[model samples]
Target: MGGPEQQVFHPNANIVRKAHCSSMEQYRQMHARSLERPDEFWGEIAEQFHWEAPVKSNFFSYNFDINKGPISIKWMEEASTNICFNLLDVNIQKGLGDKVAFYWEGNDPEDYTRVTYKKLLEHVCKFANVLKSHGVEKGDRVAIYMPMVLELVVTMLACSRIGAVHSIVFGGFSADSLAERMHDCRAKILVTADGVWRGDKLLHLKEICDTALDKCSKIGHNVEKCIVVSHLTRLSNAHTQKTPGMKPPVHKTPFTPGRDLWWDDEMKGASNFCYPTWVDAEDPLFMLYTSGSTGKPKGVLHTTAGYLLYAATTFKYVFDYHPGDTYWCTADIGWITGHTYVVYGPLANGATSVMFEGTPFYPHNGRYWEVIEKYKINLFYTAPTAIRALMKFGDEPVKKFNMSSLRVLGSVGEPINPEAWLWYYRLVGQNKCSIVDTFWQTETGGHVLTPLPGCTPMKPGSATFPFFGVQPELLDENGKIIRGPGEGYLVFSKPWPGMMRTLFGNHDRFETTYFKKFPGYYCTGDGARRDEEGYLWVTGRMDDMLNVSGHLLSTAEVESALVEHPDVAEAAVVSHPHAVKGECLYCFITPNEGVHFSTTLVAELRKKVREKIGPFASPEVVQHAPGLPKTRSGKIMRRVLRKVALNDRDVGDTSTLADEGIVEALFSNRPPEASKLLKAC
Candidate 1:
């Protein structure tokens, strides 16, 4: 796909760890053992961690049908253990306290913090004690909305120590978005900072959280407190409070009677020796909400045992992690990749990693290369989007680094295009590293499908195959699995540990959304095909989504904001690929009668959407029209719009359109002036 449109041989191919799995002996061994002896393998993993009490069944059989079917796919069925005990306390007790656990870097150039395993234990224990003093107890849901910082990690572990479920919302989400998650879980305590500094901008995070709370009515009765941490202190509201550092016997307010204290102050009451709350292997540990375009986001709940097992397993084998390897996953903590790899997976393996808070292009184009050289990193994991972005800058920036320490390279978030893969392989890896193109999702928990380092044959643009315990299937619309080599819907045939338990509070929705779509299987909402050699090629989403430059952005979410404007009454969105990005947005705006179009107006509209949503949701083009193609139920016919965006005349079935005349009008009156502006929705 790059240069000659043919794959070229890399000199480092033979040196790759694939020699250890040339025959796929390791893959076959793990796959056969994990599948045939699922219980024994998982049970063994559970025993590795300290437990408060032993459980009856190491795993509860995954049952789709059960009256009390909420995360029933549990592990260590009857066991009780605190996660903090395994993540922090035990490591310290083993004399690993002095070893660096996390090296945190903030967007601010001067912001850098290093935390050792022992100090992490103390912070987590101290914070756990603070939560208890503020009436936070077992079974409570705490919402953590903050920028990528040391406090975020400490908060999650602290909650784990106290047996409380933590729902971490990425800091950039709008207030309405924040409220949706908070209300869904009925979070008793909201932990947020005054503001967050991203590059040069200081966003008022707490103010946004406050505005979001105004729209939430579900947690009115249960919500008890708001714990605010000072970031850009000036951006805070009246509720914001500042403390020099976390200490005991801290001041408290009577607002919640038992709550309303600084994040640092709340931790002093926590005893460093306080034991982590005991948990069943199947207990719901954390709830992460995905960005849903069609409806309310689903709260993908993950249990402790099964999740820990999969996360630990993937981290160990995927990157071929070793004690001295310095790993770095360049993704925000908001996505599943960050939660599992950046936090849980790497730490569980006792491997040191870098937590980056800034963007790839931030400060300079050489930031990532500089970080690797500075830290002596061996494993570099990032998305294809990032690779391509850096590719545009050419190789001049990378020439400054001495990157010989690099060993393994990985790609996640989406399938890496063949062109990007090869570019990353040569430009970044310098023909000296094995590239693992990973493919999975928020629901898959850890890496479900991939050619792990030291395993499987190299395939450009292919995800390779399913990992251990994964039974990959290419299903048709009727839910029939296509065999051998073919294209169809991508689905998982069996239940895995990291699969989401439910759709937050809506059980029926979960069943209808995932189960009903494909009987007896998990619908991945993706389209994939296997090659003759058994390698899988991912086409794109079966659903409506424009993966603009590899960042999954929804047309509906964009159009909804466009319609919010008084001039625009309706809109249809689609994509058209460019040479750089895999795709670009195509927006067809049906403005109100008498409203004319102009390049200035279209540019303003795009800016408006950016203000409403974030910069990532901005539209590339906006075309004003009289009407949009839609169904009788008021659903936009995206298939036709996609064709129109690509400048094609022919399209598929249109009898379903609510207004067939609109399509004709869109084509007949294709405004010459509008095309000149070429604003894409």
Candidate 2:
């Protein structure tokens, strides 16, 4: 129930006066100017930042032709800059040394930590010195696998300070997943921790790192050193620990003496004065891997200067952040949201951000609201998945806290349904703060389609407008542009400063996947509709992928895992509606000619999927099918399968089906026991 008619929250007087644009008319004018004369518009904004060397030109070549080789998009290619210096040192030079940089909160309420700009710089310098002592030089890839702790931020900054590209893997990922990333990046050093507390249990992070290192070494990965941080000082020494229903390693895992070093030991005598490295603007700052349709993840590489400038500018305007205002974005550091908004974006703007170490529902459903009240957080940003998950517990948990301190609320990661957006506006915002439903991805380093909190109008389900420098286009399947008020595949017409330069080690795949689809435009892989007023409503992905609770999962990856079992002959995986998670996987498998299908086989298949990928990818439903609808060339018709999984009676045209009887067979002979199996599990 959100549209142009919804009540709007105007920016504060001070905020409006200092913003890039004050009103709707000014926003439209500035947006047009950014597109018409981007060089002049962006060059002025870039001057606000501290560049090591002046930029000669904003663009290398302005050509978006698909037939003319590759898109030659380059910005500030010859300039030199350092993101760490712009984030910390520049702020300190402006007499902001005593301002709070990060307000860290632990799982338990009693545990807390605060670091000012001066202290954060000191920590980063010391860690940079430690990394240098361990032979980590420029251009080396450093893998960071740690929980949401202060050390995580310090390590990332230290890596950037030394010109080393950091690749951060999710802490919950399995050992195989970690090894795959490490092997792909050829990481020279690995950083981890002993253990971390989640809810009432301890996750043995060091154990996972050790197991992943073993796999990495076996795969010819030459990691020179592993730096282990002691999160929990006194973990049990026993190799195995068994709880009632879960099996978690209770002990602190051991490390190799010559190749491993403790965090404290490395930082003991290190000097706290290391100069930030001067890297070319095009030098890679970090490599973040996103799930791929072909089962192997692709590392999306972002550069130093362009990504930082984009992130900082967007953070300043979108959130309308003021000095001394606390910002909290409840996202993991491993994801792009955290990398941009939580760390780089906020720090580059010199705004105080909150780092939370626990889940939203761990201690209670009210944990987020409590933090907002506890720290006087003004801007709150989080994924729509968390908002929907918390909606199930009703408004009682949210009512216990005073939410008047919140001036802006944001939804990211996935499209927010109308119901969830309404609940967030009414309950969490208390009708005082504005809600911005931002639509972007891991490839775009910053927000692409979002309403600037104070400048743009509020719309519940729609991502109102594109960011200033972004040019969005809607195109039909035949490569024809749909100008106004139409639904089509979403594409960006021009390259922006924040867009990913290339995929690590796979430039061909990057071009083939994104540009090859639409030829002249960057295909976003998602369908969308533009209203008469030019607001964008993003429908889910149009490809063979699923956005399960904001995490991208490939249907092909899940199908490949399912068919790996000996009992399965072929498999087709589809997605269906979910209440909390945006979507859940539903697998249809055809067993071998004489193989018996039973719950035992289902359990085995699930285990294989969990081992191959991560447990988050295990299908919610596994149903046996005698035959699947396919075309003449033997391609499984996923559209037909998706309709069947959703229990829709209107099955589309069967004229292209090789076997028309297969659809009837699949629907009539569907296993009744499948529902029971899903419920019991």
Reference-based TM-score of each model: 0.76, 0.79
The residue-by-residue lDDT of candidate 2 on 567-663, one tens digit each, is 6666778887676676888888877667888889889988877886677777777878776786432336677887777666588556435467888
Model 1 alpha-carbon miss at residue 593, Å: 39
Worst 10 residues of 1 by lDDT: 1-10
* lDDT (10s digit) by residue, model 1, range 391-445: 5566788878877888778998655656567767777787778777788888778
After superposition on all CA atoms, how large is the RMSD of candidate 2?
11.9
Go through the candidates in order and give each one's C-alpha lDDT: 0.71, 0.80
Please list the residue runs of candidate 1 whose C-alpha ends up more than 4 Å from where it truly belongs after superposition.
Answer: 1-23, 55-60, 64-72, 217-222, 233-260, 268-270, 544-681
| Candidate 2, superposed: residue stretches over 4 Å from native | 1-20, 58-64, 234-250, 544-681
Residue 598 deviation, candidate 2, in Å?
26
lDDT of 2 at 110: 61
What lDDT score is found at residue 550 in candidate 1?
Answer: 60
